[model samples]
Target: MESEIDRFPVKSLMERYSITRSVLYKRLKGLGIVPTKFGRQSYVTGKELTLLDQLHDPNCNPRDVNRWRVD
Candidate 1:
């Protein structure tokens, strides 16, 4: 099981990425990233967060899924 420290809530992710909830979910869906559910809340793993950061990085190529190390 993943520890709490390794998980980030959806709301926090929105703030961290400076995006709205709709945009965040849309990006995640486009990236094929499904957030884990904890009761009524949703979260993304630390690894996913790293990928998200890269996805939003101006210097990175969003189309390069193989380089993301998502698996």
Candidate 2:
């Protein structure tokens, strides 16, 4: 199980992936990954980030990510 410390803010994700906010959000939508939002901040876990990384990979088909589970 992942601890709370492993969670990251959406802004950090944007920077780590070197993607624009719009692009990241759009991909998140397409991937069906809804981040936990608290006020102005959005949180994503390391597991979720791994999935997102796969989704961001140019060679990985988005459709192939259906096998990924949050757990």
Candidate 3:
């Protein structure tokens, strides 16, 4: 992603990830993520996409996350 590319549409992202609207919002919200607020057009940043990837990644481990630290 580049500085010029600020965000991605939530619907397209949902389609790519096979996520439902409620699931997408719930997951993103739980991870402290939010989209840019506009009139009838919400969108998430590239940073959010990266974060989402990390959270949903098959290779991610419980110990890899600082917030969910494990002994």
Q: Report how far residue 27 has shifted in candidate 3, in Å.
A: 1.0
What's the residue-level lDDT of 30 in candidate 2? 67
For each candidate, C-alpha RMSD in Å?
3.8, 3.6, 4.9
Give the local distance difference test score of model 2. 0.78
> Candidate 2: which stretches are off by over 4 Å?
1-5, 62-71
How would you order the candidates by TM-score, starting with the best? 1, 3, 2
Alpha-carbon error at 28 in model 3, in Å?
0.9
Error of 1 at 30 (Å): 1.3
Poorly placed runs, candidate 3 (over 4 Å): 1-4, 61-71
lDDT of 1 by residue, 1-71 (tens): 86546888887887887889898987787667788999999988887887798888988776775555444
Off by over 4 Å in 1: 1-5, 61-71
Candidate 2 vs candidate 3, lDDT winner: 2
**Candidate 3 vs. true structure, TM-score:** 0.68
| Cand. 2 TM to true fold | 0.67
Query: Residue 71 of candidate 2: its Cα lDDT?
Result: 36
Q: If both were scored by TM-score, which would come out higher, candidate 1 or candidate 2?
A: 1
Clashing residue pairs in candidate 1 (N, C-alpha, C atoms within 3 angstroms): none
